[model samples]
Target: MVDMDLLLALASHARYRPDQLAVAFEDERLTYRQLERRVSQIVAAFRRLDLAPGDRIGIATYRGVDPVALYLGSQAAGLQPVMLSWTLGPALPEMAEALGVEHLFVGAEAAGLHNLATSGAQVWDVGGHTADIGGFLAQSEAEDERWIVRRDPDQVSSVEFSAGSTGRPKAILRTVRSDVWNAWQRILAYRACEGDRWLCITPMNLSVLSGMVRAVLVLGGSLVLLERFDAARTVAAIRDGVTILPLQTPHWSQILEQPDLGDIAEPRLRTAVAIGQRIPVGLARRITAAFPRADFVVSYGTSESGMITALSATDPAFGTPSCVGRPLPTLEVEVVDEGGRPVPPGVRGDICVRGPSVVAGYDPAVGPIVSSMYDDWFNTGDVGQWDQRGYLYVIDRRSDVFESEGQLVFPGEIQEEVSRLPNVREVAVAGVQLEEECQATVFVVSDRDNPDIASIASIEAAVARVSQVSFRIRSVDRLPRTLGGKLDRVALKRGQW
Candidate 1:
């Protein structure tokens, strides 16, 4: 079993398609050849730190092309790069210590902006000036690939944070084999090809950005990065030319709300993938009408696994609520009981998966990496079921479902029903502890200035149609979103919204 070397693959791109566009950020653009050279320079720069192969380096940067190059540079240098965001202020030190990071490359957005106590790890401000990353690139004038470290295929490739909604993020450690397999799978799963331009708004700290970067690089495609997401800017980028557009459902909602969205259509836009959460039928229809040529897919995946299931409009259960389509090729997905036995179709149970891309464990905060797998299978902690026709339906997170009034209340069910209500922009249902008691509450963001009494009644009726439990409805100005632009459900549960 031979593992593919991502560095070698990237170098091949530079050799074959040197002039093709690789990355675009603001006014700066780099061809494949230039990007490869930059990676070599970063590798040369990394050497000045007296760092050895297998040492951990933290990348805390803003949305830009440098993070992409730094990531590849880390791979070429045999350093395990742990991604961090500037938004993580006080918690940065704790995470760096836990991951055993030896050095941190801080981005310009983080320089002097936030105090990131990095748990005794040496920090380098690589955000500004020519050869600013600790003056490592300037210290050495080497442009050769001889500095590239030959690493073991089984060695940890990179560490990424888990995208769970209601828990402290985990540092998922993916091996070289897993990452290589994931990149290849994404190229196949997304049907990516040469010259395709990927619109990347998600920061490098998220797995989606890195995965897209690898696939795009492998296919000789381009990455068009946006420093910040604006509805008009996104639409303009699409009009110019964009083939792959991946974002959370909330982002799509904001785009759909664009006043001039319906006035123009982009023919070059081919794919619009919905991430983070399931795309509701209403939003799905709107996206189809907006970008009729594009294939709006509802993708369901986790940090441990690259991609599991995705919902496409062509599937029979495309519009069915919670139906996330079938698993992609080469991956094994199963719905199992508490005993780890496979459950029958139509029976809800824990979702588990086993495949080459499934990460074996997470980076522990203190000791060594701890395995999260059980008997070669990884439990997704999501409860779902399969229909008779082989379509998978995700119900909700295990912890998000609770008992109330002698009935199990799935927050997704309540939120899904209420999301259909008129004038309700967004909705989140949670059974959170308040003061001394736990109560079921429906949080909403509406267009009206005040919470309409009639709307509240409609929300209760909507939940009543789904379950017997009662819930209190409160409409707020806006729902909270994470740094990765995902709905912060845990923050909502904590009354931080």
Candidate 2:
């Protein structure tokens, strides 16, 4: 059985490798010893405030040392840490209230952006001129160190909110056993080791972020944190010998377009995992070409089910259409039709998964929508198919597929085709309802400042080559994306452009 006490491992690291670099952010660096002390101090402060187990502690902060400390401290204290994204803006307070957040930790830099006080949760500033964390650490210095609180393995340790593109975000609960097991899978899939230096380009609000962090720390590896993504900075860091780099598709696209990318020397980067969305074949090729020494991998999973599939660079099906690779050895995946019967190879059906890593269920406040438990298996609203060899291929969200002219149309297929166009910077395909029938429409972001009609026509022709069905092509300066860097399809369907 796996030991779910993550803090014990962290404490061990501090005892043996106290001086080893644990985290790096810009010019700042923290050693394992420092990280352990900081986390302990935060835990003591939380105890002094009378916060108990099961109390929801909400955290909304820019990527930095303090945010990491807060997360570890909360988990060690048995408090459920609710990660909040800044993208919520003014509506953040309302969501916090819905989550029953009792205390909040906000980055000093982001304090001016939202009035979280109205949520009635006591707020603590972390880092910046305010130095709230520093004060807390100072006050707790003389207090006895509190041992890590141990809870039932099945109890919820953290709460993660969905992207909420369609409506209110759902609260997904993650248990200690599930979280630790998921992290182990990632470590195996990404080839993470004690010597590896992992780069984190996304915010910690993402479930993947915590898993990555935990995996690295547990293995005595170093984590290089960035407050925000900058293509040049990321490329520079890779050249400086970072081994593992995990980025979303959009980040890869932006970095690929950088003019200085070609000037950088061959990077020391070994593994690069594309998270959040599928990596277009064309983009994947470009990425491989840029970092000849790196492995370009595509990973797929949901909040309800921790990473289920991963296609390594060496896998022959890496860039194959809809291919997300075989399910991990730890999990079982199946595709079934409406009647709950297994589908044949190459046939489309709902993707169902069951494993120790699967989340128990969503918090009661968030209605049951994306995931449903049936016979010990969780039905992931995503539709997919499996090849003869058992490789899984995700088509699209069940709701995103629509009927056009009595023919089933998948927006993801159209989007993938349009994404191949050289002039198209980004594309989102959606089925628009017309008077008599529904038709597919492609929203394009151009590569040039002002794309002429000729360029637009070229993209249209390229899309037509892959999809015989007629589609209306429109250009937009920018495409809306969720905080997790996924295309906001719900917004596009509502004509929010």
- Top model by TM-score, which number? 1
CA shift of 441, model 1, Å: 1.2
Q: Report the lDDT tens digits of candidate 1 across residue range 1-497.
A: 33335666678888998898888887778888888888888888778878788899888775567778888888888888888766666677667777788887777766664556647787777774323456546656545767677766678888985534554667888888778778877766566777899998865365777787778876778999887677788988888798988877888888888777776654588788887687778788879878988887888887788878877777677789888888888689999998989999989999998988887587667345345589878888899999998888889988688776677888887778887877777888877778866678888887443355336678888989988877878868788877677777788778665
Predictions in order: lDDT: 0.77, 0.78
User: Across residues 444-485, which tens digit of lDDT does each residue of candidate 2 receive?
Assistant: 887764364236677678666666667777778878776666
Ten-residue region with minimum lDDT total, candidate 2 = 127-136
- Candidate 2 TM-score, true structure as reference: 0.92
